[model samples]
Target chain A: MSLSRSSAIPRSALTTMAASRRTVLRGMALSGLAVGGANLLAACGGDDDSGPSSGSGATVKFGINEADGSGPAYDRLKGMADAYTKETDTKVSLNAVDHNTFQESINTYLQGTPDDVFTWFAGFRMAQFAENGLITDLSDVWPIDGLNDSFKQASTAPDGKQYFVPVSYYPWAVFYRKSVFEKNGWVAPETNDDFMALMDDMQGKGITPFAFGDKDGWPAMGTFDILNMRLNGFDFHMSLMAGDEAWDGDEVKLVFDTWRTLLPYHQADPLGRTWQEAATAMGKGECGMYLLGTFVVDALGENGEDLDFFTFPQLDSSIPADSLDAPIDGFCVAAAGQNQEAGKEMIKWLGSAQAADAGNNAADAPFIAANSGASTSTYSDLQKKSVEVVSAAANIAQFMDRDTNADFANTVMIPSIQEFLKNPDDIDGITASIQEQANSIF
Target chain B: MTDIEQTRAEAPQQQRAAAPPQGREKKLPTRDRWVVITMVTIPLVLVVLLVWVPAALSFALSFGKWNGFGDLDTIEWVGFQNYKDIATIYPPFWPAIQHNLIWLVFLFLFPTVLGMLLAVVLDREMRGSRFYQTAFYMPVVLSMALIGFIWQLFYSRDQGLINDVFGTQIDWYGDPDINLWAVLVATAWRHTGYIMLIYLAGLKGVDASLREAAAVDGAGEVKTFFNVIFPVMRPINLIVIVIVVIESLRAFDIVWVINKGRNGLEVIGALVAQNVIGEATRYGFGSALAVIMMLISSVFITIYLRNVFREERTR
Candidate 1:
């Protein structure tokens, strides 16, 4: 084993540097030229607002996990890519991998030779990688791209610097069957009490008030995110998650109470079902509603079910929610990436309007780009209404799964939520375990 | 890696193909055979370079400390810290091992009984025996990921077909209490047919005359089979047991796919992967778990191998 290890030192794992040598050298040479090329492309086509320069032989390989295929979603992306290629002459080598293998493949790709730009989930998940210097610093490019000031301070800890450009922001909302709501004469509510009354009325009509699949476990976490935000505003939620406070506090207890109250109304056996399965219930009108992201539109379209969207019901009317759900997904460059300039350009483009449009038009709409000064939406009214809620939100917290340190997320947060559902009596135990787990990692 | 493999062939080739002083080359079949070995060994070297080398690195990963991805030198040397943790020290570690042992027992035993019975029954020239054999053998072809999904749907407490048919709800992989039984049931369904096929092969080789002679000597059918046919299928029995043992040891996908081992169904394989792939990023811990699993599996293999060798020694 020792013999093998010593001999294997100069093997393919180290070949990452060997592989990217040419690409990095080439990209650096191009970056110097791209500074010149950007003026020409921007001046030539005033309509094309893509920041990453494109001319003859200027191409950046943008790695994405979303599948780009013959779906309407992909068609929209192709249209945007087509526009992008024509307008700027910059070819974003759209390398889309399967979602299931995305993390593993990206890890392999980055270690071997990082892509110019890649899609990343925001919060500690990306923050850890950024800390390891696996991700790049886009600080030089962020201001040049005209990113929002609020985003600069907010995405700072996550990006290792105020480097990430917010392209498109997505919001999660509760989606319900239009037919079920119409049949029951139930309207969307403005407060927690009104929502509960509506849920009771729907249950009286023999409809499940909520449908959720905890197969991936994140669906429950998503529900918890919106519930906490609605019960206590988004700032308190984000701050509490930042470990500034404990989850056992009264405000957080109220959030847990909301889950306990709604548990009876939820389709109880969502135990082994995937998010798609749970959302399919809402699509088939088996359940009155499902709380999910803009990604639900594709599932609804696949189910051919009509649906309406609504935000989480807020208790305090005075303080604004900004939005009811957690907004997630972002792009981060690898700091140790071989093609550092390409990586920066990729981040710059991802933060630019064009990348946001491409991202929105992909196989599934993950919601409009989180970019400021634009709505950036192509979803249905139900989806658009939710996006609007986020745009108008006073503040939004990224999903807890992504936001929290993964130790706490996987070990404490997920198990606690699952345990709470199985046995709520263990709340004190759950609270203690969560605190311990958080401290161990933090 | 390539240099080590091709030394016997490549050294002579370069000398003969482009020697410093070109002399008359040998036209013998020995030289021709040597040339063939050289040409063929190049691809093999490349394959090892690309595929086998990485695999070896991953295998080494089961020993040393390195997260799934990072700088090479950053891999800390922890000795057998991970293995010691799992086998003797860690809290959750032993529980996972115990769960795997429990899985191995059920995984081998349940299928053996079911397969042996099915094999004897099907050994008779029944009208639809071939169909039964084919149906039982079908699940062996399926990937574990697909099977996990199918069983998950079966064990669904609400809309599951099982509840609809049996008029009772059971959360298979979700509820913390009943999940092991659910995982075992799914695993058994897949293995039962495979064991049956092995037994069927064993039954074909069993002498029918010996069974008849036993029956003629005043043995009943049940007594004839146990005293007669059962002992003869020992070799086949060993094969089935060995497979089930190794499979139970290496089992990962079904557990991972089914709620990521949340519902008390956590096994050794699941534990190993969680450290490597999930938030823990504890490579040494994962490797330690793997080495423990390997040691346990080796014991099982060694015992089975000893039995087979012992039978041979006696013969």
Candidate 2:
């Protein structure tokens, strides 16, 4: 036994040493480029010729967030790329990554070997990247023919330069099954009292008033965005998102207090349920409404024929409910990318009505194209209503996660909001916690 | 000692005696010496570069604030500010520490014990023992992320098999009070299989004579295991304990797959990833959290290594 044990120990040690030797070699090779200053400079210099300088016949590497062959999202992107290539005779090389992976690694991706034009969102993060010089200044892409002033404003960074080209947008609203509402003779609420009555009426019929879930931790932010916009007005909400206001201040405290009152009406124990499950509940007529983006239609696998929505009702008489979260999805040019002019030219074309039409016509589901000239003939009733509601809005705010600093929104607000959901009565405690974390992050 | 054991013990001394005298006479040929130096130096340098360098950098960065943008010059020195904020103001920090402790305790209490019991029962080689072994060890073959997904089908609130079958409205993965225990249950499902396999291997290595000696002395099965087999398996027990500690400390994937460790599933590993891996870009704060985690792991590791070395020295 001792002989076998001694022999086994040496064999295992030898194997471990051999394996680690191989690992060491591999590590040295990789870290040679990573850590060696001269090698890194050489690598950067080698990247210079990766793309052509001119537009015509040049390949523009497009890094899309959706993985290839995923769904309509990928199809839409592909369709746009194909359309661009066909029109401009320039190849659009695609680098597709999964959505969450793309979002999480965005900092490293931008700083590292990013593609020419990449899928991005118009928000604090875009502005952040622009400020850091990680993204190219696309001020020349502005005054895009089909895009409206609102889109140009959304695409602008804090430096007052357009750094993004918005392709599409979707508004967060109170979504309900049109058939169910019609069956119950219910009308969309316009005032705070009307909204309360609707909830009470739904409760009287033994239906959950709201099909809410916050397991992913960002869905609930839509609720807060609308509430804050309604209660404290758009300016205060925007200022608060920008970290210019204290979270413990009454303005922010009131949002939580109001959310606490409405908690009982929402689906109970929402932390376990996902937004998809909540949307399913509303689709099944088990719940009266779900406050979510138009993507809720995707969860239900419906063309949104049975779905309709209204902007959340005005909570205070003084503040108009016209302000809503209509987060815009767009593309940005990477300053590190080799083909700067080609990327800019492609992005400018992407902002046109033709690209939007091409994208919508190819996809199973269509987005509300940001360009006003995009044909709405393919839009469902729900989408048309969304377009109308968004266009008519006096003010548009990005969702809470997008409007605020990424660190504050992700590391602070997500947990703080979840805490509020878990214990609705502790408004002061939650707000104070948020304020403390926000102070540190900002 | 037997002849084989004696020879095995004397083998090192025999090798030393076979070699030349110490000093200049003991040196290898120049080429062979160069090969030896290269082999030793390369691995040492790699280890220092790959592991120690990053660890040291994490410690240094913990004292500064950087958003992972721009160059190294952009890092602002803030001297213990990140640590102060984590301790005083970070909502997830304390809960993450508490959760890690709960995870360790729960893994030890539930899975480790249950796995040993399963191992003992299966070691009897009863009818269909192999089938039971296969069934129990299946989850161990799967990754933690896959285990999380598999359990999600059972634990999901509205559409899960548990709720559908039991007709209960339990939010198994959402309620902060209940979700931690619910996740622990899922972890145990996988952990039990792991511990059972390890214990089974250990049990298989136990000599049959030890059990026979206990049986001939009129001791019962439980008594035989407790009095004889358990002590004989001390090495395995220590290994199991260390494995449990390491597993609990690195418990991130399952919770991350579930909800990115939010809403009461805030393990330290997930917290570090949340701040550092994602767009949060709180590099210094994340490094501080990482440093705290490293300190904690080092304490356990030190105790474990000391115990292991002490055992080796005594042997």
Per-prediction CA RMSD (Å): 11.0, 7.0
Clashes per candidate (backbone, < 3 Å):
14, 2
The 10 consecutive residues of candidate 2 chain A with the worst lDDT sum are: A1-10
Question: Model 2: which residue pairs collide?
Answer: A271-B174, A272-B174
Position B15, candidate 2: lDDT? 76
Each model's lDDT comes to: 0.64, 0.85
Model 2 CA lDDT for position B68: 70
Docking quality level of the chain pair in candidate 1: incorrect
**What is candidate 1's lDDT per residue for B97-197, written digit by digit as tens?**
77888888887678768977888899997999999988888887786767888986677766678878899866666776778878888888888888888
lDDT of 1 by residue, A1-442 (tens): 1222332232232221112232233333323333443454346444454454445346666666667663543444445455556666766677666454456334444554445677666665566666666676666776734456656654576534754556555567778777778877788887778888988887887878888788676678888887777678777877777787776667777777767777898877565667877877787777888888767767655532466777777766765555454455566776534345655654665566666666455535445655653444565565556555765666667788677655456645765687777776666666665665455335
lDDT of 2 by residue, B80-183 (tens): 99999999999899999999999999999999999999999999999999999999999988878888899999999899999999999898898888889999
For candidate 2, the chain B TM-score comes to 0.89
